[model samples]
Target: MNAEAAIDLLKQVVLFALYVTSPFIVLMLLIGLLTSLAQSVTSIQEQTLTFGPKILGLALLLIVLAPWLLRALTEFASSCITRMAIVAG
Candidate 1:
């Protein structure tokens, strides 16, 4: 592929990555913030206080979103493969 096409593909890859990971990232951020707030209120400054909730939240979200995530991934992969075939031939 030409430089332009390659760059476009790279952009798409980055955007897709961000889209895919956004939910988890957002959840983690909110969980961290809430944990920090709780710790501050309780005057319990434990460094590891945030891990359990974040992990559990992430795991639950992953379970709930697994099917949709898989579908999105499958669609993206198939689209990329199709584009490759078109570019190649």
Candidate 2:
């Protein structure tokens, strides 16, 4: 493929990755902020406290978003495959 086509594919891949990861990432950020706030209020400065909630929240987010993430990835993959076929043929 030409440089422009390769760059376009790379951009699509990055965007798809960001879309798939956004939920987990945002959840983690929110969880971390809440955990920090809780720690500050309770004076419980435990490292695990921060990690545990974020991990659980991310897990829950993954469970909730799995179907949508799979659909998005599948669509991206299908589009890539179709484009590849067109380019090759």
The best candidate by TM-score is 1
Q: Which stretches of candidate 1 lie over 4 Å from their true place?
A: 87-89
What overall lDDT goes with each candidate model?
0.89, 0.81
Error of 2 at 38 (Å): 0.6
Locate the minimum summed-lDDT window of 10 residues in model 2.
Answer: 80-89
Off by over 4 Å in 2: 86-89
TM-score of each: 0.92, 0.87
Instruction: Provide the lDDT at 11 for model 1.
Output: 86
Per-residue lDDT of candidate 2, residues 1-89 (tens digit): 46666677778889888978887788888888888999999999989888878777778878888898889888999999876754554
Report backbone clashes per prediction: 0, 0
